[model samples]
Structure formats: structure tokens, C-alpha cells
Target: MPAIPTDAVRVADVAARIGGSVRGDAGRLVSGVASLASATISDLSYFSGNRRGIQPDKTSAGVVLCQSKHQDALPSGAVLILVPNPQSAFVDVLEWLFPRSEPTKCIDPCAHIHPTADLADDVTVGAHVVIGAGCRIASGVRIGPGCILGENISIGSDTELIARVTVMNHCEIGARCVIQPGAVIGSDGFGLINEQGRWRRVPQLGRVVIGDDVDIGANTTIDRGALDDTRIDNGAKLDNLIQVAHNVEIGAHSAIAGCAGLAGSSVVGKYCTLGGGVGLAGHLTLVDGVHITGMSMVTRSIRQPGVYSAGTPLDTNDNWHKNAARFKQLERIAHRVQALETGLNALRKNDEENL
Candidate 1:
């Protein structure tokens, strides 16, 4: 982090930069960005919503990015960058302050590429990368060090495969896809059968089809299907350490967070959001617009569009033990209640007959 600046910037400069208005002191200098808790005299902080209780009042920040409605809550003499959306303005400032590195066009001599591999004019292949025969790498594609591409793989234009990415044979990755380090696509599906207690291997013959503008996070694995292709639709984002099993179909624009697992043959609908550590069972269907919270175990198909959650929060051992005990007796308690209901019905019938 850089030190906070002491030279104050004019409120008109910031307003022109992001097309917003200044609500307070234009002379206050915002030299650095910081949290509301640790902000110094030259630091700038922002409050997104009503979540920050007392931190905004006691902060020493020279400037704050806040909505127009919250202008009166700021400390006296503090500079305000009034905007309709404070977070969006903060993002613009962060991007301006910290720009990303541009890709350098360079190919190492140590990379092993087949003579028939078609690399575009501006492609960059890093050291020790193996591009197999019949591979077509498009323009602006960057293959990082130690990546392995199997034969006949077609990587679309402007796609980037980071270090040690493995794309197996016959897979098709669409344009502008970003595959992070250690991601394995088109791996063999888990298919086997026991013949008289002896296991028999079932070969996976399907391909992995990844659509355009997809981002596969580091160390995620998508298995090849047994007899059909496993498809990932356009604009889908997958987080690190996720597993997509054989023949699974993920619809367009769905976002799955880290450590989530989808079992074989499951069909997830469009625009669905899955939180971290969510597990979807095999052969089930998740309809469109389903939002599952973190650490949920999904065992059945969800047909409606709504938020769903399960799993108990962390608790003390004593309380957890009591809860577990009560949970185990629920079936017996239900059976006893059914028996009592039946007895009451019989008594009511006998009283009617006697009358």
C-alpha cells in the first residue's frame, strides 16, 4: 500500500473523472484507500450501505464516498464524493490506481509445438508447453508454462490458459475463455462396473464442450462423459476446486463458487447461482433462477426460482449433542402420534354406534 497524500485535490477533478458531484470540502486530499476502522487523516473510505454502524462516525478519513442520502452522517469537515452508487465509484478509483499488467508477446524456444499446430500470428507460448498435432490456437491466446494440450484440441480466439493447464484430446474451448492454473478439462469420467465382484473399467468416449466467455478457476476439473458430451454454456463462471462430473450440463450465465461439486448427468438451468461448497446429486435437475446458499447439500431437483439453504450453523458440543439426540427420535415420535390418532378415531366411532 502507498502512503496517503497530503496535497488536496479539487472536488471538480473527481467529479469530472467519474461524472459525479462533490458534496463537501473540495480542498481535502485523499491520498490512500483504507477501511473505515483504520483510516488515517489522508485516507479515503466508503460506506456501501447501512451496514457500517459506528465506524463511519469515528473514522479519521479525510474523504468518504457515500450516497446523497447519507451525507449528513459524515463527520464535520469531511470531504464527500457524492454518487448514486458508492461501490461503483470506488471500483473506478481502484482500477485507476492499480492497473493490470499488459500481456507481453513472446514465445520461448523450449516450447514443444507440433509442425501441424496452427498458432496465430500474435500467440504467446511459454516455456515447456506441449501443443499436440492438429491443435489450433487462435490470435491473442497465451499458453503459460508447462501446459499440455492433447491432439485435435481447438482453442478459440483470445483465450488464455494459465500455467500447467491440461486439455485432453478432442475437447473444444470457446473464445475468450480464461482457464486458470491446474485446471483439467476432458478427464476420464468415473465409470466402472463389478462383474462377479471384479471391477471392470468403462471407457469414457465423450468430449468436453466449453462455451464462449467462460472462466474456469484454478484446479477445477470437468470430467468427460461416458457416452455424451459434458457441456458448459456461455458466460458461466466456475470457482477453484469445483468438480463437474460426466454428462452434466450447466446452463448459460450460471455462477458456481469454490469447492462446489456437481454429480454426473445433472442439468443445471440458466442464471442459477451456487454458493461455496454446494453439492448437487447426480441425475437431478435444477430449474432456472435457483439460488443456493453456501455449504448446502442439494439432494433433489429444485423446480422453483427462489433461495434455498440447509445445514446447521456451528454450535457448542453440548448443544449439538442434545440436538442430535432429539433429531434421532423424530421418527419414533411421529409413529407414536399416528397410533394415538388411530385410537381416538376408533373411540369416536364406538360412541356414535352406541348412540
Candidate 2:
């Protein structure tokens, strides 16, 4: 909100780009974007006029994006740019307000690329990056500093690997994907066998195949499969610190929040949303459109598409202890209740016979 605009963006220009009609001060200029609570006269904001809020009437934003139906809802304090979907239009205007810088299209002199690695002309490789043998990097791909790519990997066009990412052997990254810093792709899965009372390593023999338009967050790890490739479908999103185990298949358009984990062979169907801190047990399958709430432990496969939650609600320490104790006695209590019911039914039968 407290903007120091190197140059001002005209309200009319933004409206023209986002397909909105301006109702006030088409010539007004805003320097930056901010929330309604902190927006200044130089900042642009948005109001979802479907909801009633005092912020819309009191906000002093220089320009505002809102629906055409609520043209009269917001006070005349800010210039209104009316559109069908204000939230989506606001994002479209972000390119003009805060444009991203294009990376320099050149391989760094200090980068270590093997002779067998085939890179496109427009690819950008940062300093200290190591590209191993038989790697194929497509056009418009950007590899940030200190990244390490192993053998026979294929990164699709326009994909970006942020600084310090590690992609192991035989992985395929799709186009328009953003792999954040410290992400590990194609890491060895946790596959071990009990051999004569000793733990023996099971060689993970598969690759990780990532589809297009995926956004892998910082520090997320995806392991290689035990036999078949572990696949992440197109348009899937993964948050920071997530652990995807071996042979896991995440379907198209699925979203997973931070700190969630999937055990080996777990499959998540398309359009599913797993909340933060959710855990899926091994070999379980979640159906399409399923949503699991935060902190839930999924012990079995979800057959239907719906919002699922588990774990007991929070209570006082004493009350929780009492409830937990009663849980253990449920089987005995059921037996006693069944005995009383049987006695009452027998007495009722005898009374009917006497009558």
C-alpha cells in the first residue's frame, strides 16, 4: 500500500487488458496493489461486492475491481472497474502492476555440463549448475544456480527449476512446471526387505514422471517407484515439505497442502484435495473429488467423493482422559446392554402369552 511507484499504471489500461468497464476516473493511476484494510490512495484494491463489508465503503484505494452488479454497493471513494469476476480480473491486472523479470537466456560459464547433455538454444543455466550425461533440456527452460541434474533426464519446454533443486536419474519433468528450491525429484524410495533378521535395501528401479503445469513447492520430496514409474498428472499442485512415497500416482488437478504425506503405492484421484498435515496409509486409493480435512489419518481407501475428517475434537485434559477411558470399555458395555435387552424382551413375550 505504501508504494514507491517507479512508474504509474493507468486504470483505463488495466480495464482494457482485463475486459472490464470503468465507472469512475478512468484516467486514475495506481502505483501498487494492496488489501482493502491497508490500501492507500496510490494502491489498487478489489472488492467482492456480493458480500457486505464496511471495508468497501471505507477503503481509499485509487482503483478497485468489482462486479458490475454491485456498482452501487461500494461507496464512491475509489474508482470502480466493473467486471463479471473481480477476483479473476484482479489477477489479470497483476502482470501490469507487478511484472516479472525475464531471465537471461544463456548458460553460465561456470556450469558443468557433460558433452552428452543436449540443451536447447534458449535455455538458461545459472552458475554452479551440474547437468549430467544424456540430459535433454528443452527450449525456454531455466535452471537456477547450484542445481544438480542426474543422467538421462528430460525437462520440458518453459519449465523452471529453482535454485538448489536436485533431480536424480531418469526423471521427466513436463512443460510450464515450477520446481521450487531444495525439491528432490526421483529420490530413492524407502524400500527395504527383512532378510534373515537384517534390513536389506531394495533397489528402486523406476523413474518419476511429472506432467505439465505442476507447481512443486520448496523442500518437497518425491521418491522413485519400486517397479513402475511414479506419476504426477498435469495441473497438480504440491505444497512445501510434502513427502510422496514410491509408486504413488497423483491424478490430474489434485492439490496437496504442506506437510502432507502419502505412503507407498497410494493413489490420489483427480480433483482431490488433501488438507495440510494429512496422512495416507500405504496402498490406499482416494477417489476423485475427495477432500480430506487437515490432520486426518486415512487408514483405508476412500470409495466415495466427499469431505472426510477424523481425529477427536479437542477438549480439556481431564475430560479427554475420561472419554479415552470409556472408549476402551465400549465392547463390555455393549455386552451388558444386550443382556438387559434380551431379559426385557423375554418378559414382554410371557406377558403377551398370559393375556
Candidate 3:
């Protein structure tokens, strides 16, 4: 393990680096980072929302990052780093204190690369990585251990593939993309046919095209298309365990949360937000600005832009049983109400006839 920084930075230094104002105990010493709930006297923690403000007074954190509006809520004798947006400032501070790990320039002997593969001068290939023929790996690309890149693959500059990422043939990934471990892109789509009562596999003949600045989470699988390529637009962020079927087009700046499944031929528009566990049926289109809540089942196309929810919330055991029983009798209750209305109308008609 690398030696942690022991020198405590002055609160003024943090404010100067992140362009924030300092309040209360400017000379406080902060040596490490911690969460708001478990910060110690030499650690720094941040509070951004009301939900996170419950235990600030009880925390022993030496320094606290908060917005100017939250100054009154801090405990006495604690240093306060006030910024316009505390969360953003906290991210900058964390990045400054703990930078990401960069791989050193070492080509492992066990790595295999074809003679026709064009690799840049600064690229790092880890152990057991196989780069196939006619692959072009641009500058600063890192291929981790056990990765397999098929033929005619183009990985743009500054892209990173973590361990065990498999990129099949003829796929193009743009610059600054981070593909996590166990993510298999450009695999054959799920195409099968029942020919004479026997299941036969259909060959997937297209590639997977991923755009720039995309971050794919761990264990996510994106399949190649049958004819047209499956396209993921720029700035799209996919969370872990997502399954994207063939010919799916994800627009720019869209975010899909973890465990979401999009079937084949689905078109998701730009700026759309799909919550975790959401499922989109095949061949459906979601227009731009659509926000679907968690566990929603989108069976048809959504042309209008709004927030949609489908799944029911969890209830207590007894209340859930009662509600479930009531739910089943909803049609019978509706019929009783209709019968009452009909009897009242008949009485009113008799009175009118007598008058």
C-alpha cells in the first residue's frame, strides 16, 4: 500500500484550491478523508443535503465541507469550508487528495499482439492480453490483464479497458471511454429461429459503435446487432449489470441506472433518465426528456416528456395482505357502486312521473 499523506493541510489551502470561503477554525488540521457519519478529528467530511445533516453535531470531524447556507448547522470548533455547491467542491477536494492510479509503462511478456496491430508508443498491455490482427490502439490506451480484442477493433486515445473486458470483432470505441471488468461488447446478438421444431442460431453480422466520453460500469453486456450496428451515443453513462440487446440506439447524454434491460431494436432518446431495474420492451421508442422511475415496465413508446412510475412500494406484512385482498375485489366494488346509482336513478324517475 502507498503511504498516506500525513501532513495536515490548512483550511485556507483547501479554500484556495477549491475557490471556496473558509469559516470557523481556519487553522484546523485535516489529514484524511472520511464519510460524514464516521469522520474523526483528523479527517474531513462533507454535508450536502438535509438527509445527511442528521449527525453532524455528533461527528468528530475536524473539517466540514458545506454550502454557505448550512453554516449555522455545524458544531462549534469545527472548520467549515463554504462553497457554492458543496458536493462539487467535495469531489474536487477528494480528487486532489486522492488521485486515480495510473499504470506504468511496462509491456508484459505474456501479452500477445499480432504484427499487424498498430499500438501507440505509450500504450500499456497487461499480462495475458491478446490484441488481434489489424487492431489500432491509439495513444495512452491501457488494456488490462486477460482482455481479448478481436480483429479490426479500433480503440481511440486515452481509453481504458479493465481486466477481462472482451471486445469482439470490428467494434469502434471512441476516446476517453472507461470500460470496466467483465463487460463484453460487440458479442453476437440473441438471434434464434425455430426451424422444424429445432432451435437454430442466426449469425449476427453487425458491429457495436460506442461514442466518446462514455463510461460503462462493471459486468454490463452490450450485444452486437443482426444487420445494423448497435450505437451508444456520446456522454452516455451505463451502470453495472445492464443488458443492452442488439440494434439498441442510446442517444447522447442519457443515463441508465443499474440492472436496466433494454430489449432489441429499442431507441432511447437524448437526456433520458432510466432508473434502476427499469425494463424497456423491444422495438419501442422513448422520446427525449423522458424520466422513468425505478422498476418501471415500459411496454410501449413514450412520446411525451414526463416522469413515469409503475412499481408499487413495499408495505407492512399485515397491511400488504389486506391491500392485496382489496385489490382483487375492486371489480366487485365497482359493480356495487353502479347498482346503487341505478336504484337512485329509478327512484328519481318514479317521483318525477308522479308529479
Candidate 4:
């Protein structure tokens, strides 16, 4: 969907939004947001780094957002707005520049809406959307094109489901949630039982309960639990291509980056940050405020709040091979160290007795 574009606003007006003070030409026009290296004369950029080695002199931006410490690095003739936190102020400016618009109020003629479905009067359904029987869609909700909502599903007010979103049966999505394109909620969990040699599929009998202000990224899949519901708490943000397995509970305000996979029944506590490509083993519980670095493998439960990581540092292939070889001799080396310490202790005792 196209975002609502902002018309040109005075530099002073932009500065007022972030509580910043203008250094030059408060009347300059700012119509867009860009980086310092790519900003046009009508666009605003930010200097997010310290003044060290900064070259604002080469930037062609008409306006720059910076902290008060970096004000000395502003180029001549360039307008600078100094704020306490330049990065946050820059985000505020971006939101102002590219505000998201509500989808136009229209239920497309091609949509297949069930007669028993309960949709609010102001709800917008895009083309080819399928709302099953007994589904309830609340006011101000927008279901984009090709969305499929299964029977008995409940979508709350002001929530937006982008194109091709699939919410399977019995799921409940809370208000103000944003499910990005191609996301599949309430999908079957990867559960199986072995009968001799063949595997039998176990029934996934639970729903997915997503809380308010949650953001599910594109192509992410959240599986339905085997017995209890899969729960995502409020203010949690998941990045693209992540896998959240069945019975996994992500606590409030936790942020997970792209390509992270949470195994089945793993519980992540509140305010945790999972970096990209991090993998959590099944059934492990992570305490609150845990920060995991990228590409780390977490195999055990974390009982305290702290940064956790597993995996070796990157090294050259030859060095890696050498280290791998030495790793095999670790037990032998420990035995030698133990024997040396034992002999040294015995010799010291004997000398003391003789003295």
C-alpha cells in the first residue's frame, strides 16, 4: 500500500516537533527524509554518530538533525536542528513525513464474505478476501487483498492485515496489531508420533492468541499449540522470516530480529532482545531482560538476566581446522595438568617434613 506523502513543511515547524533548535534558516523547506549521503536539497538527514571523523561538509542535505555535541560539524549554508537525542528525533520526523493512511472505505465486489460473518460498518475488505462463517471483524479494521480468515476467528478494532495474510480457525488477534504480508497465524504445529517406523500426525487442538500492539513481520509463521494456546504478549515485535513454534510464549515488549527461530514450548521473558539468526532450543525458559547475540545457539534455560551467546568466533579456515584438532585433545590435556599438580603437592609436603 502507498503511504500518505507529506507536503513541504517549514524547517521551524519540523524542529518544533522534536524540541530542537535551528542553527540556520529556520524557514527552509523539508519535504522528505533521507540519509546524509543521499539526501536531496528538499530532504532532511541526520548525523547519528559522534563528531569524530564526520564529514558533514560533503553532504548535500538541506537540513540535518544532530545532537548538540555535533553542531560544530555542520557545513556552511546547511541548516542544522540540534536535539537531545538525534536518532529518536529523526524517527519522529520520519513518522511525520510518511504517515500511514487508513485504507479507503470500500468492500471490494470480488470479496467472498460469509453471510453469518459479523463485520462492523466501517470495516474495509479488499479484493478476493474470504471471511468465513462466524468470524467477527471489528470497526476500523482493514483486511487487504487475498486475506483468508477462517471460521470462528476474531480480529479486533483498528488492526490491519496486509496482503495475503492467513489466520487459521479459532485464532484471536487483538487491537492495533499489524500482521505483515504472507504471515500465517495458527498454523499446525510440527508434532508427530512414531508408530513402528511411520510417523503419525498429532492433532493441533489450540488457537493462537496475539495481544495488542504486536507486529508480526512478513513471511513469519506462528504455529498453533498442541493443547494450550500460543500466546504473544503486548508490544512484542517480530522481524521477517522468523519461526515461532507451538506453545511458545513471547513476553511483553520483547523484540526479535530476523531469521530467529524459537523452538516448541520455549518461553521468552519480557523485555528480551533476540538478535538475528539466534536459535533457542525447545522447552527452555529465558529470564527477563536477556540479550542474545546474533547466530548464537541457546541450548539451556537461562535463570538470570544477562547477555548469553554460544558459537565460536569467526576465523580463517586453516585456523579453524587447527583449533578443531586441538579441541579433541582437551580431556588428555586436563589429565596431564591434574597429574602435574598432584606430584607438585606431594613433593612440597615431603620437603616440608624433612625441613
Candidate 5:
């Protein structure tokens, strides 16, 4: 059985709800969503043309969401819903069918709240959560169980801090932001000064300022700045296990994938995308719309807007070793070539003189 409950919905009604146009029978009834390969006659499905082994003509789904290019490929028995973004429209259908249950606005009895902390009347604070002094929580805010909020921290309206999340002192989170489980915000920067044989720790005096509609993934650690604030602009999405070092300024609408690490003082421009395991060295900048491929290490600042990739491609172990050895002898081989060129030049001069 499917985990999601199936509902009898009309094709035209769903099209109106998702802002799409229907090409076939609008009166057709679809019960639920499924993939093209597994769709039944009563189900709805989407084809994005990128997935392998999924053909629109072979699908048995009654209602389908797809682009105009793939509409002709649909079987005559199926109903095609024309949309620019098929995946997004499918998600809208899912939301329309299965509405999320709203959390009750009530503070848990086991939670701890400081006397100076300010909370809205409709805020929800869960069990074992701690709200420190000078903290402000806006309306429609939900703090999940086992969360900790430090002093002078302000959470905007409708922001959700998921289970076991920690927000340290002087941090601000904007409205409609979702912080996933185990995320640590406003942690101290790794600033240390080497004095003789001893290392002196520098105080991290800044905060993390997160903008509205930002999504921080689980277990991601965003360190506070050494002096200024570490800022993540609106609509920025961070994947799980990402390390954002001190004073990193991530521009608006930038998406960073899992395990990506940004060192201190790095600035990423707006609409930039960083693939998984990408590393940005300290004090560098990336221009707008710059895309870095997975596992690439960026040491220099990027001034252009295009997809960039580094690191060697995969090869056999023996071939890689041979290539590495050859690369090491190039300088010596160039000197020998230079010596032969010099001797050849001397002989050519003597022949020309004799002529």
C-alpha cells in the first residue's frame, strides 16, 4: 500500500490549482501520484524528460504533468497537464492532496524560559527547550524539543527551529526560515594567534544573521564571525553537514550542497550553486551565477559567471602512476630540447656563412 492517502481529484481542478493547462480529458479522475513506469490508470504522474527508463507514451497514468515538449509523447488515453516546471507542479499537487497539520501554539510545561525573554502569544515552544534572557520570539514561531536559544537572539515570525537545534548569543533568524535538526548557529570562529610556542585564542565577537526563507540543513555548523556578522541572505539553501566558517557572506538565492566547506571571510555572490564536497578557501570571492562542480577545491577568486570544475578525472591506478612520473620529468626534458636547439642554431649559422 502507498504511504500517502489517495484522494479522488479532477484533472481540470488540479490544473487550476497548480496553474497548468490541460491537453486531454479534464474530467478524468486521478486518485494519487506515481512514477511513469508504475502509474496506474487512476493515478497522476509527471515526466521531466531527465529521468532514465521513464517514457510518457508507456505510462498508464490518467493525469500527467509535463512540459510542452513532452506533451506529444503522452499516450492518447492519458491527460497531459502543460506546465513549465513539472516537478514543482507535482509537489503542489501533493500539498493540495495532503495538507500538513499545523502545530498547536502552546509552550510545553517542561521548557525553561528566562524572565527577560519576550515571546509572542501564538508561539509554540516544545519540551526541554531553553530560552535565555533578552531573546525575542515572534508570532507563528515554533521551537522544537531539546532546542537551546541563547541571550539576545531574535527569531522572526513563522520560523521553525527543528529538534535539538542550537542558536547561540546575539543571532537573528528571519521569517519563514527552517533550521533542520542538530544545526548549530553562531558558534565561535576558529581564530587563533601563534605567539612563540603558545597559541592565543581570539574572541569571536560576531553573530550569525540569517535572512528570510532560508533553509539550513541538519548537522550544518555556521560559525560566528571573528568581528563582523556571518550573513546568509534570503532564499539561500544549505545542505546537510556543510561547514560555513567565520564571516562568510552567502548571497541571496545561493544553493550549497552537502559537505561543502567555506573557509573564513569567503564571499559567495547571488544565485551561485556549489556542488557536493566543494571547498572554498579563505578570503576568496565567487561572482554571481558561478557554479562549482563536486569535489573541486577553489583557491582563487572567480570573476566570471559559468560552471567551473577542478581535480583530476578517474583513471586506472597504473596509468595514473605512469602519468604522474612523466609529469615530474617535463622540466628536465625541456632543458635537453633547449640544448639541442642551441647546437642546431650554431650549425645553421656556420652553414649560412659558408654559403
Candidate 6:
């Protein structure tokens, strides 16, 4: 684990870094960051919303980052940085306080690189990494320990593949991307045809193309297409354990949460969000700005941009059983109600004719 910095920063310097103004004494020293509930006099904490149920008066933080709406809620003599977006500004401050160390630019002796492989200056190949023939690694790229790159793979500049990542044949990873550990890119898609009770495997000839600034989570598996490329567009964020099937096109800036499964050939439009455990059937389309809640199942195409959800609310087992049993009798109940209405109408007509 990397050590946290012991150095302290002035309250005024932190405000200047995030383009905010200091409200209290600017000379106070902030040595670390902590949560609002556990803050001390040496720690800086932030309050962005009331959803966390934080009490501002109980906090003993040296500095607090907050929006203008919550400034009056703070205790007296509290040092503060007022920003438009406290979360984003706090992220910037965190990055400024702790920067990542650059890896040494050298190929490990135990690694196997083919003679025909091309690598630019300043590339770092870690221990036991296997680079097949015709692979191209650009400058400032760090291939971590035990990574395997298949033939004809192209990795762009400044991309970091943390330990044990596997990129199979002919795939292309764009610049400034962070692929977490155990992510398998360009694996064969689940394409099979049934022939006389035996499964015949279809050839996967396409690649998995990842765009710039993409962050793929740990253990996420992206399959190669059967005939075309499976693409993840720029700035899209995919969480852990996501299964992106063959030929699926995820639009730019779309975010899919953990355990979400997108079936083959599904086109997700830009800025869409799918919550955890959401499953979409094959060959469907979700329009831009669509939001699907957690554990929802999408069975058809969504042409309009809006929030959609489908799942039964939870209930006790006894009540659920009664409701479910009544639900199964709906067709029979409707037929009986229609017959009763018809008989009543006939009786009313006979009485009117006699009068």
C-alpha cells in the first residue's frame, strides 16, 4: 500500500486549488481528509448533501467544503471552502494532495517479448509479461506484472494495465485508459449453433475496441464480436463484473453498474445509466439519457429517453402467496363478471317492455 502524505497544506491554498473562497481563518493547517462524522481538528471534511444525515454542529473538522446553501448550517468559527460542486472540488483536492508514482521505464528480465514486437520509448513491461509477435506498445504505457498480450494487439500511450490483464489477438486499447486487474478483453463471444443435438461453435473474427479515457473495472469480461467489433466509447465507465456481449455498442459517457449484463447486439445510447444487476435482452436498443433502476429486466427496445424499471415489490410470503393465487384466476374472474352484466341488462329490458 502507498503511504499517505504527512505534509500539511494551508486552508487558503486548498481554496485556491479548487477555485473556492475561504470563509474562516486561512492559516489553519489541514493534514488529512476524513468523513464529516469522524473528522478531527487536523482533518478536512466535506458536506455535499443531507442524504448522509450529517450534523454540521457536531463536526470538529479543521476545514469543510460545502455549497453556499449549507454555509449557514455550519458551527461558528468553522473554516470552510465554498464551491459550486463540493464533490468534484474535493476530488480535485484529493488528487492534488496525493499523486501516483510513475513506474520505472524498463523491461523485466523474466518477461518474454517476441522479436517482431514494437515498443516505443518510456514503456514499462513488468515481470513475467508475455508479448506476442506484432504487438505494439506506445510510450508511457505500463503493462503490469503477469499480463499477456496476443499477436497484433495495439495499446495506446499512457494506458495502464494493472496486474494479470489479458488482451487477446488484434484488439486495440485507446490512450489514457485504466484497465483493472483480471479483465479479459477480446475473448470469443458466446456464439454457437445447434446441429443434430451438438453445439457447433461460430468463429469470432472481430475485436474489442476500447476508446480513450475509459475505465474498465476488475474482472469485467468484454467479448469479441462474431462479425464486427464490440466497442466501448470514450468516457464510458463500466463497473465490476459487467458482461458486455458481442457486437454491443455502448455510447459515449454511458455508465453501467456492477453485475449488469448486456446481451449481444444491444445498442446503448449516450449518457445512459443502468443500475446494478440490470439485464437487457439481446438486440434491444436503449435511447440516450435512459436510466434503468437496479435489478430491472429490459425485454424490448426503449425508443424514448426516460427512466424505466420493471420488478415486483417485496412482500411477506403469506401475503405474496394470496396475491399470486388471485392473480392466476384473473381470466376466469373476468368471464364471470361479463356474464353477470349481460344477464342483468336482459332482465332490465324485459321489465321496461312490460311497463
- Identify the candidate with maximal TM-score: 4
User: Please, what's the RMSD in Å of model 5?
Assistant: 3.0
Which residue runs does candidate 6 get wrong by more than 4 Å?
1-4, 326-355
Write model 5 residue lDDT over 54-106, tens digit each, in one string.
66788788788999998878898888999999999999988888886699989
Off by over 4 Å in 1: 1-14, 27-31, 38-41, 52-54, 344-355
Q: List the residue pairs that clash in candidate 4.
A: none
Per-candidate TM equals 0.88, 0.90, 0.91, 0.93, 0.90, 0.91
Q: Tens-digit lDDT track for model 3 on 197-237?
A: 99999999999999999999999999999999999999999
Provide the lowest-lDDT 10-residue window in model 4: 1-10
Q: By summed lDDT, which 10 consecutive residues of candidate 2 come out lowest?
A: 49-58
Best-to-worst lDDT order: 5, 2, 6, 4, 3, 1
lDDT of 6: 0.92
Predicted candidate 2 versus true structure: per-residue lDDT over 218-242, tens digit per residue = 9999999999999999999999999
Clashes of 5: 0
Q: Which digits, one per residue and each the tens of the lDDT, describe model 1 over residues 173-259?
A: 999999999999999998889999998989999999999999999999999999999999999999999999999999999999999
The 10-residue segment of model 6 with minimum total lDDT is 1-10
Q: What is the C-alpha RMSD of each candidate to the true structure, in Å?
A: 3.0, 2.7, 2.7, 2.6, 3.0, 3.1
lDDT of each: 0.89, 0.92, 0.91, 0.92, 0.94, 0.92
Candidate 4 error regions (>4 Å): 1-6, 50-57, 349-355
Number of the top-ranking candidate, with lDDT as the measure: 5
Model 2 segments beyond 4 Å from truth?
Answer: 1-6, 49-58, 68-73, 315-322, 332-355
